[model samples]
Target chain A: MSETTIGGIAGRMPKFIRRADPAVVTAFACIVLLLFLGSLYSRSFLSPEYLLQQLKVASFLGVIATGMMLVILLGQIDLSVPWSVAVGAMMAAAAAAYGPVGAALAIPFGICCGIMIGIVNGIGVAYLRIPSMIVTLATNAVAQGLMVVYTGGFSPQDSATGAMRYLATGFAIPGVPNAVIIWAVIGAAMVFVLTRTGFGRSVYGIGNRERAAYLSGIDTRRVVMIAFAVSGGLSAFGGVLLAGYASKAAQSMGDAYLLPSIAAVVLGGTSILGGRGSYLGTVAGVILITLLQSILSVMQMPEAGRQIIYGVVIVAMLLLYGRAPASR
Target chain B: MKDWRYWLAEQRGTLLALAIFIVMFAIYTANHPAGFTANVVQTASNKGVLLAFVAMAQTLVVITAGIDLSVGMIFTLTNCLASWLVIGTGLETAFGVVAVLGTGLLCGAINGAIVIYGRLQPIVATIATGAVYFGIALLLRPFPGGSVNEDLADALTGRLFGVVPASLVALFAVVLIVWVPFSRSVLGRAAYAAGSSETAAYMSGVPIRRGKFAAYALAGLLAAIGGLFLTFFTYTGDAAYASGNAYTLFSIAAVVLGGVSLFGGKGSAIGAIFGALAFRTIGDLLFVFDFDPLWQPLFQGVILLIAVSLGAFALFRVRNRLEWFL
Candidate 1:
């Protein structure tokens, strides 16, 4: 409580803050700036409704990025995001078309579909030793093809029953959005799993140094597989929410999400290379990216100009945070 | 025989894939005998020429422990530039060709500079540049439309001599050019050495940076060639056409299938050419099979996974056995 003690604390605080991951700080700064800009541009941006709406949009991307973060944390990339989303949506929507029984089928079908893709990605990365980027890229292509072939580019619509519809429109507390709840729950669960679980430690361990991790007797392959499966499942979950939101799945609906998901992950102080990152950082990143896009939309920028800005913003963020000295 | 075995070991992945392609071709011919006729093969070869060039471009960068995702976008830029230039210029047809080629080389140089000098990773760097290149192309002609001389397209598509198409001739020329320098030049050897291990190469005075820069520049040049062929084949330039889509992935597949290690080093241009051919043949076969267009991407994904898996498994097995023997 003394003046000298307070000064000492304050001075040390700046150094501690400076040492904080740049991505986390940037994410925080960006969120504040975006909110400020959004309020200036549109009064509605400050409103609870607008914030909830933004959170709703962020939920889809945030969840997927959480999964993607795991894969990227493992020093691999997955380009199959769009296709994976499409496949998940199509399978779920198609399954749900048959009624509540079908609707119930959608969740497992989507998760299972993702799990399978994750397995392929794991085997490709671990056993086969193919680059995750190329393997995932190819898998994405295959998924796209399957989506088109199976659905003929036309998803059979499932009736959005009250519960399904509640996913997007309903909120836990009045004006507090169901999406926000779902996102918080998922984020909390992931944080626990990432921090407390053996698998989570293995993920960090393997990502940091696979050889060392293996030498330490961790089941590296299994961890990677589980990570990818979780990623695939989360992506599927996003697809399902999207389906519920729209009450229908459309072909290529996942396309817009691919870049945003990666952008979110990158923005979340997690190194793109495996070994060092956190779900908390990912949560911050998701909020930051969502806010950026929402603010841009509120600004009424043209689609092309928005894309140009999107690319610029992402590159800038990467340059600032990407130099973590831990990259391979 | 030992030397032959070593050579075979060096190129086995590509050769195996090529052998599979031949068998696939035979089956296709059996199913559609007319499809394998000389003119058909020539047409397929011609169609594959751009891919072959792009694959070569991809291989160059890959050999340097890098990748060029911007090749397709650069190709778009060149194609658009060709259209823009050819339309306004009073120059001879030869001059037009030179200008197009120049455009591509310049694009490559820019990419090379960014990647090598800027010290950016090839994947992320090319991705950003790919966007810039595509944006430039779109800025040139916003619409999915442009004009190219029909006569030029005809010449590009037509046979050079009675025996071979102009496209085929051009592709062969590329192969010859890439192969000679890659196989014989000290620079090429150094490039490969750098790719295999940058630190070791640097330690041994391999001019690793120079080799990387040159490899990237070569990749850009090859991409430009792909653009030229694309212009001729399509007879038009669309800003959105094949920008950041299948062409980049296709080129990688062709390179990988041809036995070029995705990890960098250990592949041949000859193998890349064949890989291109095989990819095209399979694409054609897919169409012939009446597979839904939706399934195409999935099938390609499966094929790529399978190919990469096989190659990776083989590589691991070989390394393990080598260690055991040693």
Candidate 2:
């Protein structure tokens, strides 16, 4: 409430605020550039309908990236995301295959599976002293293997329930997709949690230096576990939305979203090293990736070209701002 | 306290990997319908050596405390290139092999340049390059219908001396030619020093950059060898994205199982090769046991989880909370 409390480190605060500005700004600029590029290929690229379609797609990544941002905030990563997304969707759909009760709890059931995965990942990374990348990578494999066994090496037969469909595709505030609303709500919550909550500050602290945070009595492991859990939950939630949009869960549905989410996060100026990033930048990043993808597809780029461009974009953005301060 | 104790401690990981491989092979052979036959062993070795090479590549990068997510992509790319180039008469096939390996070297050098000079994180940098390599692979083999020279493929994939699988022999030869010399070299020591503590290595004026660059480039070269072998086995090159991703993940798993610390500055390619063999045997065990083929993935996953969990036991010995970071 007091200006001194906030502005006491007046010199430091501006740099902190400004540090978040350029990445988001650059992302927005890229979005505009992409829009111009897209329109050159198609006249309707700038249409409200077309843009809304792109927004709906980006919401899926936005939701997933929200969780990614959290773990990344702690300077950790969740490589389990791809299969976690599939597990969430398939389990939710499988649950809905039961009766009314199952249908009603399908979404929650799916998210719970993701949370369980996160807890395991957190245990491995936070308690076991395993690196997060390896831990998450192993968990991803485990999740995939489990999913395969559950599906009998075949695609799941269940379809997304009506509620799932409505939540993902139906218009909530007329003309606005429900998925966009969902992403916005999730984004708002993410921003509030990051800027206004102690847990958020602790995440930044631990990412910056875990020992310092632990010594400060912040219960760093609990924070890390919670972050990974949230990431899992969010990824599964994204999968659920994806299943709804597609009307069913398919094997490996989450594979395509993994790199784009990471690219979006890093493009938004969040340090892959963790400890430094903002939610707004991630939002901008999600949109940028979505547009880039849409435009690439609209241009009828082959799979090879798409992959090349995608890689080039990520490396270029990373090279631009993601460099370490030359610790050597 | 004794010389033997020091040797034992130093070779602990490699020995463990060897133990694991022997045990798994025993189980596999015991359950196998044909028993412990040369054919089965040869088949297993052929399959295992592909992963062994990739694991060796991963070991090199990880030793420098970096990771090359692109290794699998390089493997795929080189496989595809070999499919196109490693064909025709003996002279042409030789040229193609050289070309495929060269492309792999170039790819690894690019990765090293970006990571070292560009000052980017190895993980993210490799992920980006991996995408590019896979794209190139896709472009080369849009369809899985390129040919490799049959003579070379047969000679490489088949048994030698009436019993020894050539693939396994090649793997052993590579260890002698590549890993042995590298391990004894100044650059390799620098890599270890860098991985253990980059700041300390830097302060000590270690050639961290060159060491790391060599590691990355060599990793690429090893993955390329794996690619060439893949072409030999499959007789074609298919840039299956899923397969590429799987190899990348499995190489990490193999590296860990080999007792190579993912944290870096520890372990050996010999351990990783044994780890790969053990991992491959885990899959084959299911076949021998007459389990449904679908159960293979689950079995592999569980084994990997258990193998990785073995490393966690060390954490319990940390007396000081601060030492957890170390």
**Number of the top candidate by TM-score?**
2
Which residue runs does candidate 1 get wrong by more than 4 Å?
A: A1-19, A34-48, A154-162, A324-328, B1-6, B33-35, B88-103, B182-187, B241-243, B288-295, B315-326
Candidate 1 C-alpha lDDT tens digits along A33-74:
888877887688888877777778888888788789888888
Per residue, candidate 1 scores C-alpha lDDT tens digits across B120-178 of 55666677667667767776767656667767777777876665778887787777876
Candidate 2's residue-wise lDDT over A86-190, tens digit each?
999999999999999999999999999999999999998888878898889888988998999899988999999999999999997999999999999999999
Residue pairs in clash, model 2: none
TM-score to true structure, per model: 0.89, 0.97
Interface RMSD of each: 4.7, 1.1
Badly placed stretches (over 4 Å) of model 2 are A1-20
Two-chain complex of model 1, DockQ on C-alpha atoms against the true structure: 0.40
Model 2 lDDT tens row, B189-257: 998988899999999998999999989998999999999999999999999999999899889989998
Q: What is the lDDT of residue B80 in candidate 1?
A: 76
Q: lDDT score, residue A299, model 1? A: 77
The alpha-carbon deviation from the true structure for residue B92 of candidate 2, after best TM-score superposition, in angstroms, is 0.4
Chain A TM-score of each candidate structure, as shown: 0.90, 0.95
